[model samples]
Target: MTEAVQIRPEQFPLTRECPFSPPKEYRDLREEAPIARVNLLDGKWAWALTRHEDVRTMLSDPRFSADRSNPDFPQMVMGRVQDDDAEKSLISMDAPEHGPARRAVLGEFTVRRMEALRPRIQEIVDERIDAMLAGPRPVDLVRELSLPVPSLVICELLGVPYSDHEFFQAHTATMVSRQSSVPDRRAAFQAVQTYLGDLILLKEKDPSEDDLLGRQIIKGREEGTYRHRALVAMAFLLLLAGHETTANMISLSTVALLENPDQLALVKADPARTLPAVEELLRYFTIVDTVTARVATEDVPLGGVTIRAGEGVLGLGFAANRDPEAFADPDDLDIERGARHHVAFGFGPHQCLGQNLARMELQIVIDTLFRRIPDLALAEPVGKLAFKDEAAIYGMYSLPVTW
Candidate 1:
């Protein structure tokens, strides 16, 4: 195998100078050093994968473990948040444990289940749009529509009351931000964990058929898979990821489409085109690119290098999605390009379970927003907009827009 470049971990998870694309270093790494040792935010040295083929290979390969408790597992976030509990979140689990954990909630996110909720999702998106149209001009979509849509959906899904959205949303934001102090992130992380843990306890005692978590509680109990701590971890994952990632995608996608009128026209003119457009945008942003990290269980040869046992690896989703080898003119946003292999939702056993829900939400939001507000335009210049550049997930902090 070829030698991989060695660099300090602090030099990794490079900042995005352009809100629309991955960090400039991603290009350099993909072309010159597809697999390189780089220091992470926590100063841990790990091999970072930049190529589409290699990222897919590494993520799918069982040799690279996803157990975050493993000292060798990479810390991909701005601040490392640890739970003292022995139960690991599904995203951080490997093999036998991961499979059962994921399968427990898999039915909740299947295509049929997600599709059944489409009409409800449609109502939510349209209602948010209606509120936006009636409310004051120059609204922040992040607050008004983008954030609320997914936040509401997930709130109802997990049986959490929507009135307490601010509490969880605020804490969720703190946890993902690079700017958030370690103590602050810890506090936010704890606040949400405590809240969810309590909620899960209540749900377990009185299961309700009306919600996903409630239903899961009943289901898991029958299967002998419902451990309180483990359920808490799953609930936390679903609650946070359910809203945050999809919120960012909605805002960023609106910006991308607004900026590219020609491309926007394609989506607007054809209702059938919205699905591919949503997929393309998801691929284009690959917002959660930094988090798909793993550590080698044993030395595994991949992408012209051998990632040693106990070494960390990151599949640069943004870089992999934008890989020229994976698409023609990979950097350019082409909604027409049917790129099904995009790692936006990632690959392998650990792929995002809420992806079906997220996709439907995006499809409905994108299709409805533009159709309702034909004159939608940016109220502020793209360059002046503040982006969540320091966050583990890249997104616009606020998208100023008017119809």
Candidate 2:
């Protein structure tokens, strides 16, 4: 039986009253109205799925389409940083197309492959920390460590020159930020797309099988599946997503552990717990919450509500991860929770492809930073610090630390 929903739609992209946790409204809605309606920034309405079970079920069901180009698909933010306007890649592709595209690239991120990159990742973390140590007492970890680690990794993986990171990262900032005008977003998207398109041509003239995009170009043409436009869009997705999401997680995870000293002590005392703690951090701070909004292809019954065909549903992953039914003491940040089942990476067909790599990067960064700088402490209170509150992604602008 479908439960009754509320008549008044809550505003989408709800603000966090506290930086450490999700909005309190989510907790109430999870219990009372798991499928509550939300008014988006574009003034469009979509049902926000708060319950963990419902979110997982909806994401997996074929009846709900993941295609961003679908006219009825929910646009949670009015002008999103990244564009899904081009040919379908893994992100916006559904079913048959999604399967092939995912398979083509999945090998690059396999556990064995990621494990091979462990030494390199550790080196990156150590170098960043070394620089931080040698420099002034107080440094912005966002610049010193958080952003650079993932940004450099993605650049290397995609064959992009790390020298041009400033240009792309600046544009990425404008793109993800909701404060940017639609025209600003379009320009930013074009800048990235144009840069990637040119890179695609360069790879065609002189390609290397070492990097991800180049490998795809070489392999796809041989298989007769190569499309220039599709490949360019794929690069854009990989380049932006590869860096942005993980960078935010790195910063947020550090702050989380610092705030909860007991959890930090547990992790520092035992080396084996780092990976599980990273999983719990992923669950605790599900940053890209509503970006997975989907439109129903057919009338579907969910959480005691009939979502009619053409209607949209916002998968509130942040809320679902904190659902009490799926997690014990949902609000508490328990690093020992062993929350491997959490939907921080989303679930089923659309789970994050780079998850294994992300896990490895976070583990190396967190473990090394603490071990090297045993006296590491925040230079400023979290309240006084600037946060990316207006951005599509949830993270801080800077983390000032002194050791």
- For all the candidates, what are their Cα RMSDs to the real structure? 1.4, 1.7
Candidate 2's TM-score reads: 0.96
The CA lDDT of each predicted structure is 0.87, 0.87
Off-target runs (Cα >4 Å) in candidate 2 are 1-10, 79-85
For candidate 1, list the clashing residue pairs, or say none.
8-39, 9-38, 9-39, 9-40, 10-39
TM-score of each: 0.97, 0.96
lDDT of 2 at 302: 88
Q: Write the per-residue lDDT of candidate 2 for residues 1-403, one digit (tens) a residue.
A: 4354443423457777688788888887787778877666676778889999999999999899998888788886675445555566568888877898889888998999999889988999999998999999789999989999999999999899999999999998889887789899889988988999998899988779989888988899899998888888778888888889999999999888899999999999997999999999999989888867899999998878899999999899999999888999977889899899999999989989899999999999989999999778989988888888778888888999997
Candidate 2: deviation at residue 152, Å? 0.8
User: What's the distance in Å from true for residue 226, model 1?
Assistant: 2.1
For model 2, the local distance difference test gives: 0.87
